[model samples]
Target: MAKKKSPPETLLLLPKWPSSAPIVDTHTHLASTFEAYRTRYKDHATVFDMVRAFYHNTTVEALVDVWCEAPVRTVWREFADSALTPEDRTLKWGGIDYWFVMGVHPHEAQHYTDDIENDIIAAMSHPRCVGWGEMGLDYHYDNSPRDIQRSVFRRQLVHAVKLGKPLTIHTREADDDTELILKDLVPKDHKIHIHCFTDSPEFAQRLLDYFPNLYIGITGVITYATNTDTSTVIKNMIPSSLRILLETDAPFMVPANLYNSIPELKGKRLPISHSAMIPWTADFVAGLTEGKWDAERVMIEARENAKRVYGI
Candidate 1:
């Protein structure tokens, strides 16, 4: 049996707001994750609309929302294509405005070949596609052959290098392969992020050494301490100059506190976590990184690192 649900309480917020802090979300499948959230929440018009409405009448700082998504599914493509309007393309960050890493996820790699890569190349020319990825390997599930994943990943790396854009990687269990292939394929000037990092700090150090430009994306894993308990190790071991960014990896990797009573949350448990839940994850990082800094500082610095990486 499940525990009874209670209304969420708004906790006291942090102080020491940084004026120039980017507050930029390094990675988020805003439309992909938010729309699913709105649909399931039944009352919310997707997480984006709810957030937009909430901030509508309020004066706020700049926010960079990424267009990450699993465009492989026909349903995903149709829904996202229809939801994005001319104005929805950029969420108005600074006077210029922008979006984050936009690309076909590795799970959808098999559906494309050179021709499809060409088509995606054309689409990637979209003004908002500043970062290329969510396109690394995943050994946990051999959903697509390793060969196909590498081919498409290499194609995008080439495209990103040509476009002078940054790269965002998504690696699962295939970390060594990811590092090797990227070292061989990725360009020297490109910015990169190994999103949802939870490996040992040694692995984190190795990643930095191999890909000096790569940023470690700290997700909600810091809150769920067991097998995913590598955040502290990463914090202690990795250098700050490498630049660490925070991401929700929402619609998955929901933080522990939100569902602690569920029991199963002691390990991996994904039902339908929302992209808007980034705050909970961000707060978790603050606590894990020795709690030396306030929440605002963490958000600000992480955002600044993302902006530097994405050129936002």
Candidate 2:
């Protein structure tokens, strides 16, 4: 007779955040995150449904979702519009404050058109559209030609600057060009978000020193063992400076600590990251601070920094 196989351990529910500190995810992709969830579970899940499932017991207060496609996703309007009123926000997003920034990501720089630029400019006037971008150089993939990315980046920077909108920048492995272009084009006092930074500590310090108002958008990537730059940057930052912003950059960079926190997960990975996971990111960040910070303190500081940057 053959021996019977044992069933695998059921995944445990996500641990509840230990503090009342409000979570403000400075950058995320809500629609894409929803798609990831639907694909993973093979279920018909709406964005709000995914939100409820992930954000249930979390202290997620606000999210600055990115809409950076070339043509721009029409679905963005529905989300930005829905959060116009308290009742609608409660009904649609479970009372979580939702805001967005619109622009063409560097990966889509080649496809950028005048019409697309016009569309992004119009969105800047939107009551819920807080800033411009998720835009800049990305040499890691070089999905678009270098020259085209630089040209489109400059054009968008000009527009965002003219409109006096805060900037959300994405730079990967092109630190020199990114630094030069930003320093030449953007004013020192301009509100800039260097989203998902994984570059050298020197590059981070240069940006931080040059642009006092500029913030480093820290994502779950910081918790990964392979990237010490993000951790080092956090450790070196003067705690009183308040230059870090907590974000998940979700549907991506799900914090590795999450797996360790829940033993039943058993080395299995979660298919998606969301705003609710901010605390885990904060917890890891707390660990990096040499007992100077806690998860709640990290959340609170990030929340205040988000307001200063995005004014949401």
Candidate 3:
């Protein structure tokens, strides 16, 4: 028999959620399709095994087909009146209403600079491209060179400022460099967020202080003790109005810390790409707010902050 790591329930690390609140899963890797799977095509899926399983196969129409288009037009056209393309889905909810961040990640940066630069230019001209992404240093992996990562990230930030779009940053064990670069390079108008922040409270506070436009995206990591500590610290440190955002970052970071998190997900490939995860993300935050979930609060706060940063 195999030894099982205690179930999340036994771990008792349910993330915050709200019963009354709807949600907004703000920062995700979904738009970043190639970054997730450019190297490994072992399964013949376009992206890596984790991402393909997560986001590619949702049944829901309102929020289905985030990264990849569902083959059947029927599933998408029900809630949204559009064809089965990612561009169609973005326009379905409301014409050009849905938005996403795009860029070459640190790892892929080495190989795809020229192509990604073109993509960024095209995205800048796009009416709905709202942000520059999950593009920052990851010394944790050092998958790309330090200088190159800095160059691509800086270029993207410059573009974001030029476009007046917000920026979503991701860093791991590169906090010192992250802070140093942001301080020196971030433009006055660059709306910024350090998403999935798992760093110390002191760091969070300092960032909040330095960049008034800076936002912190808290995720399911808040539900677990370790993740909770980070969230608690940020909440305590940052002001209530500083554009705090929430995200699932799925079909990657599955906030599976809930007791009822995935009751029906059994034996399912999970599609790993559900936007439906937003409500769960909301409930997770609401749970932390008062041990009960309120979707409304999450939606309002998240949207208001998002609108402020995104100007949408």
Task: Note the residue pairs that clash in candidate 2.
Answer: none
RMSD, one per candidate, in order: 5.6, 3.6, 8.0
Q: Which candidate is the best by TM-score?
A: 2
Per-residue alpha-carbon lDDT of candidate 1 for residues 92-186, written as tens digits (9 for 90 to 100): 32122335456667787787666656545665665555666667787778788988887877777777778877777878877778778887877
Superposed Cα deviation of residue 144, candidate 2 (Å): 0.3
Least accurate 10 contiguous residues by lDDT in model 2: 4-13
Highest-scoring model, lDDT: 2
lDDT of candidate 2 vs native? 0.87
Q: Which stretches of candidate 1 lie over 4 Å from their true place?
A: 1-22, 45-48, 54-98, 237-242, 258-276
Q: What TM-scores do the predictions have?
A: 0.74, 0.94, 0.69
Candidate ranking (TM-score, best to worst): 2, 1, 3
Count of clashes in candidate 2: 0
